[model samples]
Target chain A: MNATLTLTKLDVLRVRRNTRYLILAIAMPAVLYIAVGNSTKQTSGVEFKAYYMLAMATYGAFAGALMNNAARISTERKTGWTRQLQLTPLPGGGYVFSKIVASLVTTIPSVVVVFVLGGTVFHVHMDAWKWVVIALVLWLTSMVFVSLAVAIGYRFDPDATQPAVMLVFFPMAILGGLWFPLEGTLEKIGKWFPTYQAHKLGTDIISTGRISMESVGIIAGWAVVFAALAVVSYRSAQEQ
Target chain B: MSPDTRTPNGAVVEFENVSKTFASPKGPVHAVNGLSMSMQAGQTIAFLGPNGAGKSTSLNMLLGLSRPDSGRVALFGGSASDAIKRGMVGAMLQSGGLMSEVTVREQVQLWAKLHPRPIPVAEALKRANIADLADRRVDKLSGGQQQRVQFAMAIIGDSPLIVLDEPTTGMDVENRQAFWATMRERALEGKTVLFATHYLDEADQFAERVIVINKGRLLADGTAAQIKASAGAKRLSFRLPGVADADLYRLPNLVHVERQADVVRLQTSDSDATLYALLDAGYRPADIEIQALGLEQAFLAITAEDNNHGAGAGAGTGIGNLEAAR
Candidate 1:
């Protein structure tokens, strides 16, 4: 347990230093929110700033969570870091466990940066309890992408992981109304995506002060599927 | 433990009839073939082999990173992973990767924390001669410096069994000396050190025992001097300008003879007898030099002899000849 935690600590430290992750997960979202978050217009029965706050937070959280961990895992596997760790006293699952824990920790800054920007710069006001619940929900749902990242990372080599991540994630982001709220046929089709559902969970909380179980169910379903995929790929990769 | 460290020694490592095969485009490749060896506690053994000689495959199985198709690999009387978990084995692999962003101190410290009974991180750093580079990011360092960091990580645990695969691959001369000095200290402290190296001189100088493998089989196992002796160990060379090729060929104990211009070179099992035979012929060879052939020549001679004898049997693999890796 101590060894696992020590590895997790080092992993988290390295994640903090990763510039690309910071730019994708924290900087990009913060910039997007500042550019279009404030207006007299309302979105989903709330101020545009408040709605966009949740969108960017969700975007940042999942983006950082996926991009940071997936690339690192692929590169580490290619470089034999995973093989090196096998020689240590660390348990068989410790390396992946630490990576997951580090993702959970590092993705926080992405969510928090966008949240703080929304509150301070764009003046998105809400009850303290609402803020806490929304942040927690956004944080928890991002694990869906974290698991997807692991599955993709383990399935592909380092060279292929970059394009794989972009191809799968960019569409999910665009179709999910994360860049802007969706309506009509787009919104209806987008609702099936985990990213869309994750964003809806946040918006549902803000608009109605209560969350929909359907959105929760869709996100949770993807989480389970991806986590299973992660385990299978990780095991098969080790065999190679 | 200290008293029992010397021979009549307990076995620190045991590999009994192990074999592994990998399926390649060319069909099943025998990476290791019914190989067997054992190491006594407290021996500094060098594993010498030509490329594709199953050195890495054997090490991987011994460290429990991979499984063998048959037979067994044991460390400290148990499974390799158990021994490793008990803080009994420390290893540095040629293919192992270091964490990219961490400083040397943090990386070594993390290793220290991973082991159940690690030596102090500072002590490990000093022993590896990388204390000055402690603040530098590990990936930012040169290849040699990164190798030192790997060295520090390996020794931080202070395990009784130290396994290094090509440990000095990128090190410069000065650091290589320091690395060996530290390894010698560990050997003196009764640790079992098994290392694989491409540099035969390192095997010649540092290993008390050398095990040479070719085509996934043990070719020779002995002290460096003993192996050298078995390979017609010395080169007797001189500028005997007027000497005929026939006259040089008649030198007693000559295993091979070659000439460059007026200079003559002879590989001989007994340098003294060969020199006497030359002198008795009344040819005073000028600037005569009888240099003992180093492990490189000895290793080549051993492997080349094995490949020739087995050529008919092992040619189907398309990798019949040993690479004699430089």
Candidate 2:
């Protein structure tokens, strides 16, 4: 337990110290939210600012799990940092847990940026309970994609993993209603994706102001499957 | 059983009939073939071999990075797994194995966290002689400096055993000497060190025992003097006066003799005995020099002789052609 905490702290420090990426992670999603949200003049029943704000929040959470996690892991493995960690007394579980914690930490700032911008610019209305629920759903959704990113990163070398992560991430973002709401043909396809389940559960809880057991079940199922796969793939990679 | 047998202090590391085979596209390549040897604690043992001699494979097994196909590898009278958990072993592999973005101090502290009780970060940096470079990023540092940081990470826990695989590969002559001094200091402090290097002179300077491997087999294992005595051939060179260079082969105990221009070089095992026999045979020539064989010569003699015998055995079969191809 001590080893795990130490490793997790180091992982957080690494992510925190990388200033350029941290800036980009926060700026990209919030900038997208503001630019797109203001360009639309119509209140359009659902406030444009609130809708894009929620979408970008989900985007930030997804990026933390997918792009940021994958890149960091693949680069570390390629540079032999993973092997150095393996040589230590730290258990394999500790290393993976540290990565998850680091991803979660990175996701938090982006979440705050989205919420603050939403409240100030869009004047979006949500009670304290609703905000808390949205935050919880966002945190839980981050875990599923983070596990998938880790699995891909461990299974492939940096050169291959980066492109592979981008390939998977962009499709999920588009299909899961980041760019626009999943409608018509895309909505049918999006329902099958883990990201879709994550966004669906998140949007349902935030907009409906109620937690649905069905959405929770779907998100929970995806998290379990991805986390299990990540663990197995990581163990196999360590043996290699 | 005697206390020595049950808890041996001499052999800090022992490999009993250890073997490792890796799968290749062609077939299974035997990296290590049933090798057994032991080294006393506080001794600096050099593992010398040519490329593909399974030096890295054997080191990996000892470090618990890979398991042997058969037999056992024990460290401090315990298995590799047990030794690893005890934090009794430190390693500097061929790869520097450091995070590129992290500063020197951060990397040291991260690894230091692995031990239950570890040396302070300042002390480990000071020991590696890289205290000044503590704030420098790993990728920003020179290869030698990065190597120093890696060395620091390895030794931060004060592990009793240090395994260095070609640790001085990217280092300059001065840095190499400095690194050797550090390693010598560690050994002097009663820490066992297993260093694998293709550089025989470096091994000769520091290793108390030299283990030479060739084609996945242990060719020789002993002290420098003992290995030289067993496998090293003495060389007697002289400028022949009017005698044909080819005629030097007639000298007794001369396994092979070579003539270049007016000088004849005779390689034999017994330099003193051969010198006397040569003088008694009325072969007294100007500038006769009987030189003691160095570690390089000893390594070549053992591995070359082994290959020769192996080739000789496989001559009748088509495998001899494959061996020659290799």
Candidate 3:
């Protein structure tokens, strides 16, 4: 357990050392939310900032999980760092778990940035309990995407994994109602995608002031499935 | 334990009928062909082979990074995998498996945590002769410095067995000599050192026992002197201008002779006899030298003989030639 925590801390420190990336991670979603939130007019029965805040928060969490956790792991494997770890007493499970925890830790600042900017600039309103639920839902949703990223990254080589991750990342963000609001035919299609369900759950928790057990169950189910697949893919990759 | 401490004249690492095959586009490619050999504890053994000779594959199997298709690889009298868990083994493979983003200290610390009890960071740095560069990032170091860092990581745990594969790839003669000095010191401290290198001279100078593999088979296994004696050929050179071919060839036990403008070289099985024959033949040459066969010559002879014989009938594996060489 201590080894796992140490490894996770080291990974987080490595990410923090990248000044440009760190700044972008903290600022990008917040900037996008503010710029788009203020310019867009209010929607029927919902304020624009409130909608933008939730979507951008979801985007921030997903990006942090995918880019930080998966991309870094693929690069480590390419450089044979994973093989080095295998030779040590550090278990394979600890390595993967550390990556997940580090991704979650990095996603925190990004989520906070969106909330702070939205609350101050766009007048988004939420009680303490509702805010807590939104944060938990966003984190859980990020876990699912992080697992997916790990699976895809380990399945492909470093050279191919990047383009492959982007291929999945952009579609999920745009089509799954992360970049914009989904309604009518789009909403129906978005419901089929996991990211959309994640974003929907987050928005519902914050705006409706209630937790939907069904959406939470769906997101948790996807997380478990993706995490299992990631473990299998990573182990198979070691053999190859 | 002193690095040079021998393992009580017995096997510390053993491989029994080990064969590893990988699926290729054409068919199954045999990487390790039923290789069986054992290394005594505290003995510095050199595993010499050409490219694709399965040297890396053999080391990988011992490290538990790869498994043999059929056979047992045991380390420290236990399964290879279990040995790895016990932290009884250390390795420096061909590629330096390091994280570029971390500083040297951080990297070393990470590995240190894996061992139940590891040497202090300062002590490890001092031992590896890289104390001053502890805080520097790995990528910032020179090739030799990077190698030193890798070496530091290998010994920090103070494991009983240290396996180094091409550890001196990038070092110059000075650094190579320094590295060898450290290796000898480690061996003297009763640690078993198993290393693989292309430099025959390095192997001859350091390793007590040398194991040569070619085409996925062990070609030779013995002390450097034993290998040289078994091959039975010595190199004789002289700076003799205008020496007649007949006179040079007439030397006793001279299997072959070559003459350049001002130098003549002879391949002989008996250096003492050849020296006496050269003087008896009335040849007065400057800087006359008779050199004993080294590991390089012995290795060449063994591998060449294996190639000529092809795969032997035993188990349809190439390692039969290895046993013959031994």
Which structure among the candidates has the greatest DockQ? 1
lDDT of 2 by residue, B205-324 (tens): 899989988777788888888887886468888886677544455556664567788787877777677777667777767888988888877666666667667853332322232244
Over B108-142, each residue of candidate 1 has an lDDT whose tens digit, in order, gives 99889989888988999999999999999988999
Per-residue lDDT of candidate 3, residues A1-240 (tens digit): 777788888888887776655665667888888678885565423576777787888887888788766677787787777877777767668888888888888888888889888778777887877777787778767888878878987887778887887898888788788788777987777676777877677667665665667676766777788889898988788777
TM-score of every model? 0.92, 0.90, 0.88
Q: Tens-digit lDDT track for model 3 on B1-326? A: 44232234456799988999888896777889999998877789999876667888899998888889899887876776676776777778765467766798988887788776688988778777788888898867888888888888888888878899888878878778878888898899888899998778999999999888877787788898888777665888989877787777777875556778888877676888888887887878898887777677766665655665675422222324334423
User: Of 2 and 3, which scores higher on DockQ?
Assistant: 3
Which residue ranges in model 2 land beyond 4 Å of their true spot? Answer: A39-45, B1-10, B241-259, B272-285, B312-326
Docking class of 2: medium
Candidate 1 stretches with Cα past 4 Å from truth are B1-9, B238-257, B270-290, B312-324
Model 1: lDDT of residue A38: 73
lDDT of 3 at B187: 96
Sort every candidate by TM-score, greatest first: 1, 2, 3
DockQ of candidates 1 onward, in order? 0.75, 0.55, 0.63
For model 1 the local lDDT of residue B278 reads 88
Q: What ranking emerges by DockQ with the best candidate at the front?
A: 1, 3, 2
The Cα local distance difference test for each model comes to: 0.87, 0.77, 0.78
Q: Which is the winner by lDDT between candidate 1 and candidate 3?
A: 1
